[model samples]
Target chain A: MPKVTFPRMGESYRAFRMLMNDLGNEVIIPPRPNKKTLDFGVRYSPEFACLPLKILTGTYVETCMSGAELIITSGGSGPCRAGLYGQLHKKILNSIGFPVDIIVFEAPKSHPIDFLRKVKRVNSSRLSYLAIWECVKRGWEKLKYLDDLEKTTHALRPRELKKGSTTKVYREVLEWIDGAYAMKEIHEAGKEALNTLKLVPHDTRRAVLRVGIVGEIYVLLEPASNLEIEETLGNLGVEVHRSMFLTGWTRDNTVKETSGILSVKEAAMPYIPLCIGGHGRESVGHTILYARDGFDGVIQMAPFTCIPEIVARTILTRVSREHNIPVLTFFLDEQTGKAGMSTRLEAFVDLIRRKKNAPVSDNRIIVG
Target chain B: MKAYMGIDVGSVSTNIAVLSHAGEILADLYIRTRGRPLEAILAGLTEIAGLLPAEVEICGCGSTGSGRYLAGVMIGADVIKNEITAHAVAASIYVPDVQTVLEIGGQDSKIIIMRNGIVTDFAMNTVCAAGTGSFLDQQASRLNIPIADFGELALSSSAPVRIAGRCTVFAESDMIHKQQMGHKLTDIINGLCEALVRNYLNNVGKGKEILSPVVFQGGVAANAGIKAAFERALGLPIIIPRHFGVMGAIGAAQLAREEVEKTGQTLFKGFKIAGLPYRTGSFECGGCPNNCEIAEIYEEDRVIGRWGARCQRWDVL
Candidate 1:
């Protein structure tokens, strides 16, 4: 059966809780991510336990303790610490004296054997098939809505009257979206929001650049961790795309396993080729692709201690120069501040606008 | 007219090597991966294809490294081996008498001990990055020194100082403290080198039987300081091969050669893997009480591999 988990996210925890309630999987939802969860993971896990690793391991432990025979999760084995996390979690939990039965869905692009096994572990009689399936579809729809909203609103928000008001509204919308009950309601609300958003009168013809955000999932997704860089880009009239979403990650993993026996051409790239390997392959690939696709600039994001993204950022300078694209990288962690990130992004956006004639904001308040 | 393609997908970088039947590299590529290896492997293969003549017959294909399973699946690789085996195979092919293999990458580092051309015992630090190449990169950047010149900087030290080599944070802080105490740049840099060696020895190489005719590879091989430190600490003249950076690729390619030789055909899916739309995402696992945050990658809506599970029991499921 699918267990609900809040993980370590404070921003999305409540939303996940609400969704679990609506989906009727509220009983199995794991606790929110915390230092204790991380401790549970780090103590039992390998020395260099990343935050997500700790949370996942801790969540699995908690689920097993709750007498759950089978738990549900997704996994990948690739360049990021994330890919191997499934294996690491299993090892760590077993070593820590837990009899937790681990069930994971394979990457959407790889072999189905792992996921198939997980499905078997779950007693079909105990599972609410309708609820679980419905939850995923709804989640996908929500993702699509957010993706669409980001594309439309970002196009003009850079030139908005209040400049940062669109981002302000975006934050409000994300908060509300967490509580949104039905797809129809979200769509209706999104349309209404977009109409009101256009009332602010953003410039339609301002040339915009594209920025790719990559690195640790937590730092990339949580604005508090990364200083709301995506929103800052939006303010600068730059379209931002964050790699490591729920969909693409699944796709890459599904492809990675079975493809190994397929051929050497694709085998060379177990994750995302032409990108950063080891740590930040997505950022590296996204950077190159952004350049190849004619994006004016790329911004690489990561946590301070993350080696893979740092490696990718360093090599990105060579790629940036080789491809004649401007690349800026930021390292975020618990200690990161808004002022510093804003300053860097401000300069990077300015440089891109000048080189590519993509107008962006020069003045913006530091987001905290 | 004939060639072998090897793909090395690791936790840090993906490398592709195309070798002539006579064991000469026609072309090779190394790329740091943000988190995905499939794309990196494909990119390297595609690049080599662009640079090579289409008439070149790919006799065999091999995949190795941490992401070997996925790599083999994507490219239809004939041979898949653990990094230690792959590295040993490639090293043996180049220098059959190689007794040890030292590989330090971005996220992880390892030491493979070999005797009589076979792996004895190996220790790998998959969860630590204290002495890896990325650590060196960080220190060099903090010192505002060019990473390319990092090795030479340590080589210039007349009297090297010692810094704590236990972890990157301590080593960096100790270096800073040494700087505050007015140590020379060369000496400080050398201290950093010593720290790297100490960390590697104490951590990964702890009590391992390290014999020589050793080969050092991976990203950190470029650092002369680390190489020298290892030589001094081990009391052995360690040799680093020319294709150090792409050892994984070379290994992957060598494995490919073996596969082709044995199977009499190639499993390479070809070089045009670029058009495939790839995507990835993450979700917390709900299995058991262990809500493992699971990451899923997709290629046109299919699941490939699932890792990060602490329970290998999922495999049987």
Candidate 2:
């Protein structure tokens, strides 16, 4: 069986690892994207390539160096540069003389049977179809459980009486979830984690500011890329509501092709009438939804030179104006400084706080 | 009399403002940083200390700007704020009913939308130096005119020539071409100001509602040419507040006062810090593959601060 490896994206990697392991393959999870990973990626990647692509390249190189024979990454088919990432990454890796087989699970929009055949090839385990289905189900359950725990952590982090309590608990909970092998054990661990979170002293009286974070999935999920924006906001007494979750994204893309009502595309209609590829439409839609949901503010973060995001940004300004909801946009690149980001975040949080406390009769026209 | 102090150490300039308990500006100093923030900060502090009455005691202190962390550590600031908050706070204090604040500083520019003394929304120029005071300074030097006279020269021009302001490099070439075509220097200067304002509106201030009672400040606020250009661009009276150049420092001081009021104590090290021996050094941490450049600040021989490490292993605070 070929040893498989994949880049990390939040807790989704754990599920991927479990699935790959069950399929009779040894899984080597690449180290979390860090300074070295970025350095490796930036050195070889095209200078104008977006941050995610560079980081992905770095992860692949690192995995290849670590003797991972097979690399599995998702594929996109759209006007966005993401669609070309698979081919580009394969070419870049080949040019660097890295020995690895790359498999991209592109959505079965055109060649349905080819996608099924590719999936069957990856699943080399000679188990019954029922057993394979059960394994997949268990893997999904773990992913869902991890997502739920993360949601709880997000809600409780700002309200915790002692700073870092929620984070400490969250770390312990993640370990508990990761350690559980069986479905029953996973359920127990999740329940135990939720109970542990409840024990953290919370300040119920404090009015926590709510802010929604929407942007590229890679940056949003990876802490190192976005500088742990959610954690930063949480530490600043803010309850952050993220627009993208791994499970939610999986469901949106695979399970439900048509997200009819309360959809991001529908919400983004007035501003961006068409899907301009990538998550541009979703970014605009989520901001509007957040505003309508009475969030104090929304932060849109994207990689520098990302085409879809750049297009979304121009329209976001109009959305911000028409909706009368404040939106702060950050374009992250290798040159982006932590201190600069910190300053902007601090100022943004302060602005939101001031706006929240202002007298209701300020006479400005209100909009949803 | 007790005084609160605020220091803003920016890329091009360092500003210090001392304020009394009644929110009155007691002493303010603006000095060119010239790549030496420590010296500029010390000079501004010493000048401010000398200008103020001996009876006035320094109570609380705050720091803001790109070099805020360094300044905060050096001054023992009670409140350390970003330039955005500092500028917005100062503008609100100066003009209580200010709905919009267009602040163009030495290295950056920002559009702050305020409603009823509170900042509702704000946008800063992204990694661009075209819409800043530095660009104007460069243009002024190129035109063989002192930066002090650039604004007045711009205001004097009746027929301002058009210059491309989308990029600094393009704008410079456009200015040269206009100059070669026998355009008046004042007209070119005015044109440059207009170009900057247009760039600001199209980029930083894009989709931002520019309401009236607009307060313009920052180092560039001293330029009448840019102020007039902004007023013309917005078709609204741009109010340049008193002490516009030192507003960031003033805002920091005001925030420091607020901090002191809440805590009933301050972390201020006092004005004596101006004479203290301060030094900064950086080294690459080899603990991991990250190779983070850890910067350390020394007061005399004791290391008072350390930062820039991705992992908290090297962080002092």
DockQ of all models, two decimals each: 0.01, 0.53
Question: Could you tell me how far off, in angstroms, the CA of residue B306 lies in candidate 1 after the best superposition?
Answer: 4.7
Q: Give the per-residue lDDT of model 1 (tens digit) for A1-368.
A: 34433343324343445444555453455665433455565566555555456556766777667654444455544555666666666676667676555555655445666555554455343446566666656665656555555555656566776666675566566655555668787667666656655666676676567766656566665444455567667766787765545444433455453331223224224333553434365566666666667777766766555667767656665676566666666654333224344434554564455455423324334799
Clashing pairs in 2: none
Q: What DockQ does model 2 achieve?
A: 0.53
Q: How does candidate 1 score on lDDT?
A: 0.66
Provide interface RMSD per model, one decimal.
Answer: 20.9, 2.3
Question: TM-score of predicted model 2?
Answer: 0.93
Name model 2 segments beyond 4 Å from true. A108-111, A126-129, A258-262, A362-368, B141-145, B156-159, B176-187, B283-293, B301-303, B309-317
Q: Model 1 over residues B1-317: C-alpha lDDT tens digits?
A: 99888888876778888889899988888887658676776677667788887688777788776677667767778787666667767788878898888988776787876656655445566235788887887787888999989989899999878898887788888899999999999999988888888888877776566787888988889899889989999999988888988887787788778767777887766666555666666666566444555555565677655544433323312
Report the Cα lDDT for residue B316, model 2: 69
Give a tens-digit lDDT track for model 2, residues B105-160: 88889999887677788888876889999988887777778999988999999895
